[model samples]
Target: MRPLTPGDVRIAACREGDLVALDRHLPSPSHPRRYTRQLAGLGTLLVAWDGGQPVGHCEVRWDGCAAAEVRGVVGDCPEVNGLFVWPESLRRHGIGTALITTAEDLVRDRSGPRIGLGVKDGNTRAAALYVRLGYRPAVPRYLDRWSYVDQDGRMHDNADPCAFLVKELG
Candidate 1:
């Protein structure tokens, strides 16, 4: 396989037609519902593609922060949530960073002055990445709780201690 670079990735909001492939590469069939949400003007599923492969994704909740503690703190600024790059071998090759910066650009294009995201407390690596990207602590730690069903039909209910972080776009 050819080595991947930042230049090799193309990031864009998940379109109606991208749902099928997204359902395949992404964790679950949630992309379809996410696409419906996108169409309803709620949030967007931004997908990062490397050539023909869907390599990463991050949801931009344009309405406001998804975390309860950070919600009203940043007004209506978009939130970058659930950023992921598949295949452990592909990490640190700029794909995750590209997804984040692209999300920022998209929000900045809409005149958004800031953005926010929640990081699970134990996820030091992700927190470091957010800090390097200029996000700072915004709210006191809170419970990060959610549930999801995987492609295999298993349901997961998770709750974690997390912190909300925000960054001003320059």
Candidate 2:
């Protein structure tokens, strides 16, 4: 597991190329532009590489507020967002945990006491992964209430609801 800087060779700053990689791995291109813009404004975007190929990526942001805010939901804490590991790379090693740990450390360096993220309801695997990493549910589970249509002509509503999970940085 190697750590990559923003413009490193294997993990160049997430430009159009990395966006292609991300689209291929994610369930849909629901918010790639939004995520790209966020990555541009946020501190750093970390991508993991296997043999010099981009394999996984995560984004970390510092809330200008003394508190954290995700999708307009604000809290008195720092947060991490847009963490995704390529499906093809799951379980081959500890890449996902490494990414999360890196995000935690970055937030901690900023004097953040806690970090938080929201996981879609039904993504049990991701939720479980967070739990195993010491994150616990911190906000009431609620329906997302937003909707989008995917490339497959399928509609998904944030209505599926999500649990906001948080981890205290020590």
Please tell me which predicted candidate would have the highest lDDT against the true structure.
Answer: 1
lDDT of 2: 0.63
Top TM-score prediction, candidate number? 1
True-structure RMSD for candidate 2: 5.7
Give the per-residue lDDT digits (tens) of candidate 1, residues 2-52: 798999899999877777777677666557666777898888889999887
For model 2, the stretches where C-alpha displacement exceeds 4 angstroms are 1-40, 64-76, 145-157
**For candidate 2, lDDT tens digit of each residue in 13-50?**
45556656555555445447446656666445666665
| Pairs of residues clashing in candidate 2 | none
